[model samples]
Target: MDTDAILALLDGQYLLILGAVLLIIALVAIIKLRGSVHQLGQEHDQLTRRLDTLWHDLDAMHQDDTPSLSGKSKAPTTSATPDTSPELLLAERRLFEGLWPVAWALHDKVGGFLRAVESGDPHSESRLAARNAALEMRSQINRSRPFFDAEIEGILTQLVDIEIKAHLTACQYLDQRQSNLGVSSEGSDVRESYRNKWRQLYDREANELINHLVSAMRKRLVRHVP
Candidate 1:
């Protein structure tokens, strides 16, 4: 085959791989969302069963004049916050997993805009949307960081920092593009910077943290199931 044909084939393969990744991210988002709902349902069912058993025990105790021991669980602790519930923690982990899909989608949007600018179209609405999404995701991370363990929080803070930088570059690029002024010379550099950030988030730093959290959460969550 000629060199040109080989290059074209390689490009096609690269695109196929990227498409597969995007599809996987979309599926993950759906699965994690479902997992959160399912865990909630399980916890709710357990709570109802426990309540019913307590009521029955109370009735029997009244008739027999004996103490009730219907529930096998420990007495209530001072902290009844959802934070202490295993099901809620699992749901929280799944919910945290759900955020990455949005981050990946925003990565894709920024990538597309980078390509457009490279082809001389200047940055477009897509990049602006990506910037906004990154900002919103950062806000979400802030609200959620406290719920997680310290290790996870450390990874998340880094992710938020990257988001801030990426968004600032995007904002500046869009402003320059909208003015009659041509695309800035720094556009290529910023594009490269975001590409690195994407890799760090999905393939390296954030990926490792996600695996750890998932493993820890699953173990604890199973113990709480009725």
Candidate 2:
């Protein structure tokens, strides 16, 4: 071959090698981009799952249909609080579980007390029932004494106020009905005045009960984050 022919052949080979290098570089770049995209997808999916979990927890807390303490095999604690961290859940769970049983006992005691007032029997049955309820409340407060810090104490105080109001309202209504049954000619005016007073007292107590229950529940609310 002549020099010109050999030079042309060498030039064509060089061009082919350059083209091959460019193709390889392109493939490597494409592979690296794909890897990055896959990593981003994984990260996005994890974030989505976490967000969904947080939403579910909030919904559960709002729904108020969670299992009762008795039905719950484990502690009835949850990460349902709003804007809470993961570490907070464990800490809160410990605190909440410790307080729950005592709270429930107090609740039941208050309920029983209210029912006794409603039973409308002013005899020994009523007095005994009231005494037992009061004893139960005292017992619960003593048992939960250790866990009752400022926050928990405040909550319990609110709850007690609610119970007292509800009991007084029901009792007032019962008392009014009982007193209105027997009236004499001379005492008719006094009985009527008493009935009116009881009615007013009942209304006031009912309102206070509702307000206190709402306030107590609101104050106990916690925030959680997923």
The best candidate by TM-score is: 1
RMSD of each: 28.1, 25.8
Task: Quantify all predictions' global Cα lDDT against the true fold.
Answer: 0.54, 0.49
Which residue runs does candidate 1 get wrong by more than 4 Å? 1-85, 167-226
Which ten contiguous residues of candidate 1 have the minimum total lDDT? 71-80
Record all residue pairs in model 1 with backbone atoms less than 3 Å apart, i.e. clashing. Answer: none
Candidate 1 structure quality by residue, lDDT tens digits, 96-182: 576656555545565565555546675647656655555565556567765655444444444434433444444454445555543
For all predicted structures, in order, the TM-scores are 0.39, 0.33
Model 2, span 201-222: residue lDDT tens:
3344333433443444344444
Best by lDDT: 1
Worst 10 residues of 2 by lDDT: 70-79
Off by over 4 Å in 2: 1-127, 161-222
Q: What's model 2's overall lDDT?
A: 0.49
Global lDDT of model 1: 0.54
